[model samples]
Target: MTGAVVAGAVVGGTAVLGGCAASPTAPPSATARADVTRVTVRLDDADALDDVVAATWALGVEALREGEDDDGTVVSPSSLLTALAMLGEGAGDGHAPFDAALGAVGDERTDAVNALLAALARYEGDPALVAADKLPVVPMLHTAQQIVVDDDATPQRAFLDRLAAGYGAGVVVDDLATRSDALDEFARTHTGGLVPTSPITPDPNLVAVLQDAVVLAAAWKTPFDVALSGDQPFTVVGERVLVPTMEGEFDTAAVSADGWQAVRLPYRDDLVADLYLPPEGSAAADDPSAAEPTTLAGLSTALDDAAADRVLVRLPTIDLESTTDLMTLLAGLGIVGADLTGVVEGSAVQAVQQAVLQVDEEGTRAAAVTSVGVTESLRMPPPNQVVLDRPFLMVVRDTTTGWPVFLAEVLDPRAG
Candidate 1:
C-alpha cells in the first residue's frame, strides 16, 4: 500500500535544537557538520538510562540470533535505537507498538534515548580529524541524526518539533530519487568514510527516511603489545583457523556465571567493548542462538557484581562488516504496520542497518548507519525489477569481445 504525504510546507519560526539550525540548501552536506554538533541537555533520569541500556543489549542479542552468517555479525544498538526512537516519536496510533518493543513509553522512552545520545556526545569529535590508517591518540565518536523527506512531501510540524527537541535531528527536504548522492555524502562525512554510502535505496513511493550514523575510533587504555601478536589457532564455528592474534594481561571488569565468561575492555575514555564468551564445548559457544536468553538479559547485573582485575586474554585481530534488513526484526518486536500519521499519513516503514568494525593491537574502530524509511502504502512501479531467487549461472563479460571477465554458480547470496 502507498502512504500519503500531508499537505503544506514546514511553518516558519520553528526552533532548531542543539545550537545547530537546519540547512536551507537542497544538498544534504550543507548541514552535515551542523547535524553532528554535540547535543547539550541534562542527563535523563537514571532509570531512563537503565531502561535504554537494557533495551539496547536485548535488541543487540536478538540481531545476532537472527543473523545466519557464521563468519561473524555486528549490530550497532545505539544507531539502531536512535533511528527507531525517531520513528517512535512520529508514531501516532502506532506508538504503543514502539513502546512495547523498546520497553519504555512516553517521556521515559524519549528521555532515555535523548540521554543516551547526550552521554555518547562526550566522545564525539570532528570526523575530518580521523584517518583510517592511523588510529587517533584521542578517542572520538561521531554521531548525527537526520530526517529526509521528499521535496514534494510536507512533514508534520509537531513531529519535526519533537525530533528537533528530543533528538537534535536536522531535517532535509530533497528529492529522494534524484538527490540520493547527497545523502551518501552525508553518511560518508559523518562516518569518516568508514561507510561511504547511505543504505536507503530511493524508490518512487518513498517519502521520508530517518537516519542515524555513528563512527567510533579509540585507543585502548592498555594497548596490546605488537611483540606479543602472532598467529594462533582460533575456533570458528567448530573448525580451527590459524589467525593473527593479540595476547595480553590487563586490568578490566570481568565475570563468570550461567555458563558464560565476560570482560569489559576499556577504551581511553568512557567507551568499552564488552566481550562475552559462552562455555567452551557447548553449542552456544559455536552458535549465538544456542545460549540461554538470560545469559545476555542479565549481563549488566552480572558485570555490575564483578570488579576490575587483571585478566589474561588472547584475541584475534579482525575486520568485519554486515548489512541487514531489519523490517522483519522490527515486526517481530511488535512494530508491524506502524501508524506514522504524526509524520504523514499512510506510512509504511522499512529499516536497514550497516555496520563495520575493526580490531587490532592498537585498539578498535567501528562505524554504523541505521535508516528507517517511510514510504506511501500505495506505490509506483519500480524502474527495474531483478530477482535472483533461484540457482543460476552468473557471468561478467566484455560486451564487445564476448570475453568472460568472471563467472560463477549463483546460489546462497550469503556465501563469500
Candidate 2:
C-alpha cells in the first residue's frame, strides 16, 4: 500500500519545520569524505547502546509486521534508522518523538546514530559478488543521505549543518519543479541502480526533500553446496509446503532458552543471520515485534550465557521483495509532528520506499532506496529454519558490531 501525501499544493510558509523562502537553485553534490571521525566510547556503556539499538530495531520490525500483507517480511533496520536520524537532525536535538524513535534518551540521539553509522562504516569489506569469470567480489556498504530541495526553496542552515555533520546528509539543490527525472536519477545512481526510478515525483508546492539510500551484498563464509540443496518441507504456520533448503553442518553460535532455539548462520566475513526457532509445534506469536527486545537481548545474552557449538543446520533459500510506507508507520510508533513544509509554496509531503532481497547457496544481495518528496505530504507505511522446516523469526545482522540490519518473520518463502 502507498503512503499519504499532501494533495493540494503547499503554498506559503516560513516555519522552521518547512524549507526556506529563497528562490530555487541547485547546489553542489554532497560527496562523502574519506576520513570519518569516531566517537570516544567505553566498554561499560556498550551494553546500553546495544539495548537501545535492539529496541529501535524491534520497532522497525513491528512496523513491517503490521503491514498490509503477510508476505515474508524484509527490511533494513539500518536504513530506517538512518532516515529517522536525518529527520531527527532536521527537528534539532530536543525533538522528543524523533529522539525516542531512535532510542536516545536526551541530546544523545544524534550521537547514538553517529556511533552506529561510524561503527558500521568502519568495518568495511568487499561484497561477495561471485564474478562469472573472476573469483569473487566484496562490495562496501553504500549508504548515502541527501536533502533535495526545489530550486525556489532553501533548507535551514543549522539543520543542514547538523544533518551533514552528524548524519552525513549532503544538500542537493535541484529543479524538481521542471525536471523530476533528476531526482529519479539520483536514487538510481546512488543505490547502484537497485531502484531504477526515483520514488519522488514532481509537485509544485515542493520544498526540501530528505533522502537515504543503503545497499549491502555479501558472500557466505562457507558457501552452501547447490548439490546439497533440494526440495524440503516448509511449514507456513500449520500448513506445510515444499521449498528449497540449504543443508549443511555449520560450526556456529546457538542459544536455547524458554523452549526457543536461536541459531546464528554466518555469512562470509562479518555478517550473520540469527534464526529463532521455537520448540516443535509451539504456536507462533501473533505480534513478532513484541518479541524482538527479549529475543534480541536473548541473542546477545546468549553470547555470554551460551557457548558456540557446531550444530547441524538446514535453512531455506529465500528471495523476497517489499515496499513500505515509513511515514505512517513511524507516526503509528508515536513520532509526532513531521513538518515537511516549514518554508515553501507547494503541495503536501510524504515518504515512500522500495526494497529487494535474495538469499541462496551464495550470500545475500539487499538494497533499499527511500525518497522524501518536496511537494506535499506523507503517506505511510523473514525467516528461519532449524531444521528451519517451520515458521521462524530471522534477523540479518552485522556480526562485527552485532547490529540487526534486517529482520524477518518467514512463514512461506514461496509467498513473496
Candidate 3:
C-alpha cells in the first residue's frame, strides 16, 4: 500500500478528535538542546539502548496494526528478507554476535505478529483451513563496530585490535592533523559519521565490558518532488497560510466522522514513512476544547464498510526530510527499564548497550531533484484531491515484522 493512502486512513480517523499543525523550522532552543543531549548521552549505554529500541519498534508496529484488519499478520516474506539483509549489512563482521544477542530476545515478537495476521485473515472471512496454514517467519539482527585510536601500540588500540581480530577484520587508521586541520572531521569520518563523539570513548580497561550493535536506514522507492510543489493556502488556528504541497497518487485508507477525517500514507519501498493526518476541530491537546486525542481504535471503526469505500483521495505531493537518532528516540518511547541503568532478566544480568543512528537530507535539494520533481507534477491533472494542510503523525514501519521503524510529527510543511 502507498504511504499516502495508509497515512490518509490514520489521519481521517484522528481528524475526528483534533487537528494538527506543522512544527516550525528553527534551531533547537536551550531546553531542547539539553533534552537532546541528555537523550544522546543516555543512549551510549548499550544494553539499555537495545531494550529501548526493541520496545519502541514493537510499539510502533502494534500501533500501526491496531485498526487494520490484517490482525498483525506478516504479509510479504521478501520484505522481511530485505529488512534482515539491511540488518546484516549494517552488522558487517559482527553478524554472529549480533544474531546471538537477537536470539536471546526470544520469539515473542514473531509470535505476536503472526497471531495478529492470523486474526486479520479470519476477519477478512478467509476459510479456517487457509488461516491455519503455517506462515514462514524469519527474523534477523546484527551489530557493527568502529574503533578510534591515536596510535596502534596504545592499550586502547590493542583492545580494539583484539576485538577486531575476533570479528575476523582489520582496523583502518587515519591522520587527524591534515584532515580539515581539525579533530571534528577526523572523528566524524572515522566514527561512522556520527557527531558529538563525546558519548563514545576508547578505554582499554572497559573494552571487554562493552557491547556493540548495528543501525539501519531506509526510505521509499518513490520520492516526493519539490519543483512542482508550490506554496498553497493552508488553514491553521483559524488563519490561512501558504504551505508547500507535493501532489501524487498513493494507495491510501481513510475514514471520516461528523466533520472530521483521518488518512494513512504508506511509502512504496519501506514500511516506515506511514503518516496519519487529522481534520479540523479534532486536535488532541490536553483539553478536549483544546484538541481531540485520536486513538487507533477510533480510526478502525471509522474505516468500516461504506465509509472506507467513499473516502475521496487527491493526495498532495509532500516532500519530507526526517532524521532520527535511534538511541534518543528509543529512550523517548518509555523503555525506562533499559535506560543507562542495567536490566535484570530473571537471573541474567544485562548492562546498557550502545547503538547510534543518524539520517540527513544529504544533497536532496527541493529543485532539480528527479524523484521529487516527478511526484510534484502529478497533481496538475484534474482529479479528486485531499489537501494535507494540517498536522499529522508519520510512522516508519518494517513490513515483514510489522515493526515500527520510527515515528515523527509533521507539524509544518515548510519545516518538513
Count of clashing pairs, candidate 2: 45
Task: Report the C-alpha lDDT of model 1 over 40-101, residue by residue, as the tens digit.
Answer: 55553535665666676566556555554445655665566666777788788889878876
Colliding pairs, model 1: 1-377, 1-378, 2-376, 2-377, 2-378, 3-346, 3-376, 3-377
Candidate 3: deviation at residue 224, Å? 4.4
* Candidate 1 Cα RMSD (Å): 15.1
Global lDDT of model 3: 0.27
- Model 2, 241-264: lDDT tens per residue? 898888876666776777777887
TM-score of each: 0.79, 0.79, 0.38
Clash number for candidate 1: 8
* Residue runs of model 1 more than 4 Å from their true location after superposition: 1-41, 44-47, 129-132, 289-294, 378-416
Q: Write candidate 3's Cα lDDT for 1-416 as tens digits.
A: 00001111010000000011112222211110111111112112223333323443433333222212110111111112112222222233334433432322213322332232222221121111111222111111112222222221122333333334322122323221112111222222222232212222222211111212112222333334444456666554455667655544444556555544455443333233334456555653111112222343244334322221322332333344221112222223322122111110111011111112111211111100000000000325423345566555444344433433333334444433
Every model: Cα RMSD to truth: 15.1, 8.7, 18.2
Question: Which candidate, 1 or 3, would have the higher TM-score against the true structure?
Answer: 1
Q: Lowest lDDT 10-mer window, candidate 3?
A: 367-376
Q: What's the lDDT for all of these models?
A: 0.56, 0.56, 0.27
Prediction-by-prediction clash tally: 8, 45, 74
